[model samples]
Target: MNQLNVCLSPALIPLYNVEDHIVVIIDIFRATSSICYGIENGAEAIIPVSLVEECAAYREKGLDYLLAAERDGKVVEGFDFGNSPFSYTKEKVAGKTVVLTTTNGTHALHLSRAAKKIVIGSFLNLTSMCDWLKLQNDNILLVCAGWKNNFNLEDTLFAGAVVEQLKTGDFKPDDAAIAANDLYQLGKHDLNEYLKKTSHSERLKKLGIEKDIEFCLQVDLITAIPVLDGEMLVKLQ
Candidate 1:
C-alpha cells in the first residue's frame, strides 16, 4: 500500500521525502480554499509566489494579472485582493490570471515544489481531491500550511479529514496520518464549532471575515482540484 503521511506544519516538511510523494498542500482557512474557488470559477490560472514582491513583479510585466497578497490575516495594501474565496467569483475571475501570495498557504506551496506532484486541498474540494488522490500511484504527503511555521488546529483538522477518507483506499496511514484521522473523526460532525477557538479562526474573526471561515468549512462545494503546473495552479483537466 502507498503510505500516507501528514506533515503537521511546513516547518516539518524537511523531514519528509517530498520528491517521491504527491504533495497536497492544505491551507483551509483561506488560500487553498480560494484557489479551488477561483479555478472553479474559471480563472485561467493562479500563480502562487512566496513573497508579496514576487507577486507584485507580475504587475510590472504589463500583463493583466490580478494580484493578491495577504499577511497576518489581512489583505495587504496595493493589491487587488487577498485570499478570500468570495473575491474569486465567476464574474470577476473568469478567463483571468491571478498572482497570489499569502502568509501561510503560498509559502507551503513553495516549500513543496520538489514533490513528485503538487495539488491544492481544502474542505471545499475535499471529496474531489481525495477521489483523484486515490487513483495516483505515488505515496501521498498532506502538507499543512500551519500559521507561520507553527502547528495550528484548522490545518491539522483538514489533514485529518483527508486521512479519514484516504484510509479506506490503497493508502496506509503513518503515525501522523493516524493521529489526524482520529482528530477528524472527533471533529467532523461540526467543523465550525470544532474550530471556534483555533488561533487562525480567532485571528480572522478579529478581522471580521467570518464569512470566509464559514465558506471554507463547507464540504465538497467545489469539485475542481487545482494542481500545480510549472508555477501555476490550474484545474486538473
Candidate 2:
C-alpha cells in the first residue's frame, strides 16, 4: 500500500517528497481557486512564485499578463490585483499570462515541487482532482495552504475531502489524514458552516469580497483539474 500523508498547513510545508508520489495542492483562499477558474474559463497559463521579487521578475518581462499578489490579505503595492478569483475573467485572462503570489498558497506550490506530479486542488474541482490523482501510480501527499504556517480550517477540510475520496485506493494514510478525514466528514455537507469561522473567511469579508467566499465554498461546482505543467499551470486541454 502506498503511503498517504497530509500536511496540515502550508507553514509545515518545506520539502518532503516520497520517492515517486503525486502532490495535490489545496489553496481554497483564492489563489489556487482562481487558477482553476481561469483555466476553466480559458486562461492561457498561470505561473506561481514563492516571493514578491520572483513574481516581480515575471512582471518585468512585460508579457501580455495580469500582475496579481497579496500580502496580509490585501493587494500588494502597485499590483494590478489581489489574489481573488473574481478578477480573473475571460476578458482579462484569455491568451494572457498570470504571474501570481500569495501570502500562503504560492509558497506551498513551490514547497511541493519535488513530487513527480503536482496537481492543484480546490472546491472548484474536487471530484476531477481526486479522479486525476487516483490515476497516479505512486504514493500521494496532500499539501494544505494553511494561513502562514498556522493551522487553518478550510484547507484541512479540503484535504480531508481528498482523503475521503482516496482512502480506499491502495493509499495507506498517516495520522494527519486521520484528523483530516474526520474533519471533512464532519463538515462536508455544511462546508460553509465550518468555513465561516476560518481566518480566510474573515479576511475575505474584511476585503469586501464576500461573494467570492460563497463561490469558493460551493463544492463540486467545477471539475477541471489544473495541473502544474513545468513552470506554468494549465488545463490538460
**TM-score winner among the candidates?**
1
The 10-residue segment with the lowest total lDDT in model 2: 10-19
Alpha-carbon lDDT, every model: 0.89, 0.80
Clash pairs detected, candidate 1: none
* Tens digits of lDDT, candidate 2, 21-92: 688888887777888888887778888877777877876687777788777667889787777788787877
**Candidate 2: segments with Cα more than 4 A from true spot:** 71-78
Which residue runs does candidate 1 get wrong by more than 4 Å?
71-74
